[model samples]
Target: MEKTDFDTLIERSKNIRTAYHQLELQHHGSKWTIEEDTLAFLTDAGLVGRNTMSQQGRWPKTETDAELKHKLGECVWWLTVIADRMNIDIKDAVEHFLTKTENLLEK
Candidate 1:
């Protein structure tokens, strides 16, 4: 198998979601706005945090390792998708994020 780079991941993720949303548009006659989709992903990110707590025994051991990894992957996937929707490359976003955080940390 060919090694998948970040660019491939971004393309594959975008293609999969485009197909999914096409189906949603066909049957539901609607798709969520970018803000709505971002909020939905934010909710999923929160679930990942909750799962972390559960695994740590802070609440309950409810999340398996695979499940936790899946949610975390989904969070990254959604972030890439949102960045594409906003016309930015995920690589650029990552660079911008690191630069901003480093500058903030130096303050």
Candidate 2:
């Protein structure tokens, strides 16, 4: 397949979300609240409970390297949808964020 642009990915993500929503509606379900969806998205991405280290005093028993990798991909998909919905150029947004962070770290 050919490579796709950020805008294309965003459009595709919207389509996927629409289909997911339709399935929920068909099953007499409700849309996920923003918070719920966000949590769900993060959990699915393996970024929630799979922390490599425990902040409270111990290391995590379960390894999450694979889960974290998968979740990062999912996060990119979610981000594309959000950026598209907001009419933002995700590519530019990412660049701007990186640039800002780099400049801040240089201080």
Candidate 3:
């Protein structure tokens, strides 16, 4: 697979959100309410159930590593939507956070 840049990832995330909303409109006769879409995306991404870390004590588990990775991607999609809805630039937000953490650690 090819590596994607930040811009590409953001665009792809937005596209997925748009497609999901379109489907919702078709089936439910309305675009997704903000909360509904966020939760639905998270659930579809398999991040809804009990926390995986909490289940680490159990030797046997059903979900594969690949599934977890996909769920992580879904989380990115959710974050992208939230950022866009709030008119926040996620790239800048992330950079600011990283810089702040780095400065704090250096002190």
Candidate 4:
């Protein structure tokens, strides 16, 4: 079966996260808990927000465009990882959210 881009993204994110977990086990003697993963996601999200503010001239101009873009991508990666950890299908969740929001907006 052909894989959609999102499917590829999900697989890749899971693979990379699993690899990182292994690395954590080696270096730290344990992998992160789901709560720690959530915290890490929030940390990345905060960086994304800071970069956005920098872009909008609302914060110190500390990050480059590339940095901002990378942070944005990292946020998506975190969301995918978090969803998978929670047994939620990220694609379906996003689809439902968009559909419901669109329907509401059209009303």
Candidate 5:
């Protein structure tokens, strides 16, 4: 069977993160702990919110649409990595969330 898109994303994200960990080990003496990674994800999530506000004209238009789009993608990549680090399967988690939400909304 062919791999799903989500499966491909998980694999690629893990590979990229592994490469970054190697660089961090060489330069910083250690890879970041999961807590540090979660903090980084939160930081990016904040940027996504700020850029979204800029796009919506709620804030000063300091960022371009391309920059906002890049941040949005980065947030997804961060979520995948964070989930993997926590021993959660991101694809399954998303599926469960969607299914549960849909069922709730159907009532």
Candidate 6:
């Protein structure tokens, strides 16, 4: 497997979100409010959890790793979408979170 940088991953994720939005934008007719987006993001996150369970054979909804992997990717899409809509960078957010957390623990 090849490794990708965070920027590339974020960019690719944003591109996919754009493509998907193009398909459904007309139906939504406008962007959702932050609250709505947050709910949607959480829903996507729950789906990811379910996909993880499936991958682990814990009452799986999906029959294959491929399906689970696709769901996992969809979760990443939600993460990127939520961050984009909220005017945040996921890479920066995670890095800042980790640095803060580790520093706090060390002190």
Instruction: Find the candidate with the highest lDDT and give its number.
Output: 4
The clash count of every prediction, one per candidate, is: 0, 1, 0, 0, 0, 0
Instruction: Give the alpha carbon lDDT tens digit for every residue of 61-105 in model 5.
Output: 865588888888888898999999999989899999999999999
Instruction: Report the Cα lDDT for residue 97, model 6.
Output: 95
lDDT by residue (tens digit), candidate 1, 59-91: 667646778899998998899889888898889
Error of 3 at 92 (Å): 0.9
Clash pairs, candidate 4, are none
TM-score of each: 0.84, 0.61, 0.79, 0.91, 0.91, 0.71
lDDT of 6 at 61: 71
Residue-level lDDT tens digits of model 2 in 1-107? 59988677877888997887788778867865556556666666555334434333355555566665666667887777656556778889999999999999999
**Quick one: how many clashes does candidate 3 have?**
0
Q: Where's the lowest-lDDT run of ten residues in candidate 3?
A: 48-57
Count residue pairs with overlapping backbones in model 4.
0
Which clashing pairs does model 3 show? none
Worst 10 residues of 5 by lDDT: 1-10
List the global CA lDDT of all models.
0.87, 0.69, 0.75, 0.92, 0.90, 0.76
TM-score of 4: 0.91
Q: What tens-digit string does per-residue lDDT give for candidate 3 at 1-107?
A: 89999899899988987897899889989887778766776686655343364255443566555666666777777887878867899999999999999999999
Can you write out model 6's per-residue Cα lDDT over 1-107, one digit (the tens) per residue? 79978788888877876776676677877646667767877786777677778778886375757766776777777777788878998989988999999999999
The worst-scoring run of ten residues by lDDT in candidate 6 lies at: 59-68
lDDT of 4 at 43: 96
User: Which TM-score value belongs to model 2?
Assistant: 0.61
Q: Model 1: how far is 18 from its true place, Å? A: 0.5
Residue 96 local lDDT, model 6: 100
Per-prediction RMSD in angstroms? 2.3, 4.4, 2.9, 3.1, 3.1, 2.7
